[model samples]
Target chain A: MSSKKIKAQMRVFQELENQLLIQADKLGVKDDYNPIKIKEMEYDALKNHLLSFYSERSNIEYEMQVLGTDKKEVLIKLEKLEIYIKRAERLLDMYKKYFGKVFKTQNEEKEKIEKFLTKSRISVSVGEN
Target chain B: MAYEAPTIAANLSQDKMFSAQKAAYQKLKEEVPKEKQNEGTQQMSSLVWETVEGKDGSKTYKVGMQDTVYLAAASSALAEDEVESLSKNNNLRFRDKTLQVLKNKMVKLAMDTFSHNFFVAELSKMGVGVITFQMGLLGISPAEIEKLMSKAREEKNIAVKNGLAQVASEKALFGIVTGAKIV
Candidate 1:
């Protein structure tokens, strides 16, 4: 993964995360809505993917503890976990803190997530494939 | 050395989502108990008062409060001064700032991995060092990348060589909030 390629993949991860945020916003139907708790589900799936990539457990475990198993608590957990993100420059692993977590959507759920994402505010570039 | 292709372990599961929240709700329900349930779960409202100045003269912003779950998601990124404002409260505002920063950081990393562009003026000066902190924050092993690079060199594939070289840039890898080119 040469530092360069890792860097490249890192960029991709950020883009994907942005796409997911917009998706979450739509799935829940309001920027501040919480009845569905879709955001944590989003982070959860993304985290699972990254954890599998390296077979690591500590950070994710740490997050689960902070976020608890509940959706409401997950929002609070987000704040605590975020402090760690501040040090990302020194801990490249920090990116995983944000990027990991597979939002846990599939079947009808996948359609829903996709719909939200599709309807999300997307800035399109023209004349380029 | 062993070679392990990147694999996604699972997809998002609705059962997982509902169960987690249900569990929390159940716990809260338990706190009420059978006899006192109705009285216990009743919403208890708290109000905070503040004075405000309107065009006429002086007015007030009630600054009412909820159970903290109701506010609109804080803007996903704020300047240092804004961060300071959030901090002035009893950490409630700070938590929002943290969440927003967390959100922005998440997007920034994915963007860097996909785009690999130097156009982001914020992190470029940071160079390859961005890889460690950004990747580490995600809990992904920066070491994994390092190992892959080492393996690539030993194998000496021209394609691999080129890819590895591109990753070594020292850009910040992410920022407080990814804005347009940081200009």
Candidate 2:
């Protein structure tokens, strides 16, 4: 990981450490026990919290590893999609060329005029019916 | 019939109260799991400590607060182990780890108490002679105090392997040489 990533990780750990210290403070000295004695219990709870917190962080790291692999797979899939898109674009260009050729044909204008006349006649027939 | 209804309600209430008490007692009696104990030991093993070899070939591991807290939790349940591997060696390891933790804690406490701004101002009022005399009485030199401050800042996790001479003497002055296990 980069230094920036490591620094971000350190900041997260520091935040967790601070939160744990707060929790430890809330576990004020047990009146029944002396300072050292209460501090001992507080220490145990803090340790457990720290252990579990680190455990969660490790789990997150594993997840990040898994996600990283997923990213590579996604990138490969994206490359494949881009290839498919390029092929489709080529097909579209071919269709456009074919349509352009057909439109430029000598009979093309007559064909469209005839079709329009036929459609108009059909509409007139329908009106009559 | 009326008496029977009231008796059943009373019995149910009593049962509920009894179970609540039992649960509270069980919570109090709960022991640290063997798995957690093993995990704690595994964690402690990973920490780097400056090992000091004693005169009698004993070893004391000096470590910072993080290691100390970890080892303290691990060693809390060290005594009741039925496992063969958790023998005298493990106990001694735990003891030494705890002692190192205590030593560091004492060092910090001494620094905070003696070197606070308010305390320094008050000490100055007494005169420079009193300040020198106090250091002499405490048997801790100004250099050692400065070293402790520097080490505390620079070291996140460190141990002075064979660094017992100064620590032992300081412990004597601090009068808290006992191990973590006793505390």
Candidate 3:
């Protein structure tokens, strides 16, 4: 993906990071806090944040090349850039699917436990609940 | 039942009250399936379930709010399988794909999200959801998460991916600015 897209993705990171930071500051030292207990968020998104920046800069440079600088040879490189963008997106998805389970909460685990325990009565409750 | 004097009743007419109750009853009645008219005895109740995983090397899967919600709303009958996603990171590695069955809802959500070929947008939405949860976990670095996010973003076309990324970023930023999290 272009740096623009990378920047876009980073903005999302920053947004979530910022919100957690705010919540940690908001709740004070005592709340029921089951769903969210430990406040373990890290900053320093700048490194990868810049990856997109570089990508965006490069794409604009590529766009400039296509619209003006070395139009003939750069076309192939441009094609490759587009391909990289597509590839990058695919990789993100695969990773997300593979890795998204990392963020499960206790509530979810508890629910799963509750559901399984309750299934013996599915036939009976199927009409009742 | 001539409820007329109380502030609650003054707020609504008896007809409105009965209509609302009737509507709810009507919906439930539909679920009951009238007197075995041969419409087929479909599922009418929920199976209550409580999942338990082996404490030793239970498979880990990365689940999101969307999946959590589905599982939360899931009847006890389905999703008996155990899955462990990242506590607040990007991947949910599992020793057995048997747990992949739990992801049926998530996969269904993805299919629904991309049902009309919105794969790119669908990927971005999942990314944002995952990233948000990761931020909640202590010690999570955005770079590491981005590395994963970038990889996940690869599933879509460039233009579409870029667009979704930009939009998600903007909304995320908006959430941050407004101090909204835990969705």
The native-contact fraction of candidate 1 is 0.00
Candidate 2 vs 3: which has more TM-score: 3
- Model 1, C-alpha of A7: deviation from truth (Å): 23
DockQ of each model vs. true complex: 0.01, 0.00, 0.02
Q: Report the Cα interface RMSD of each model, rounded to 1 decimal.
A: 14.6, 29.0, 16.7
Task: Residues B100-137, candidate 2: write the lDDT tens digits.
Answer: 33335434432232221445423332332222222222
Evaluated against the true structure, the overall lDDT of model 2 is 0.38
User: What residue pairs are clashing in model 2?
Assistant: none
**Could you list the chain B TM-scores for each candidate?**
0.22, 0.21, 0.23
lDDT of 1 by residue, B56-150 (tens): 33322222222232222233234466444444544354334445443444334323322223343224213223332333333334345445334
Q: What TM-score against the true fold does each predicted structure earn?
A: 0.18, 0.16, 0.19
Best prediction by TM-score:
3
Off by over 4 Å in 2: A1-73, A76-129, B1-98, B106-145, B156-183
Ranking 1 against 2 by DockQ, winner: 1
For candidate 2, the TM-score is 0.16
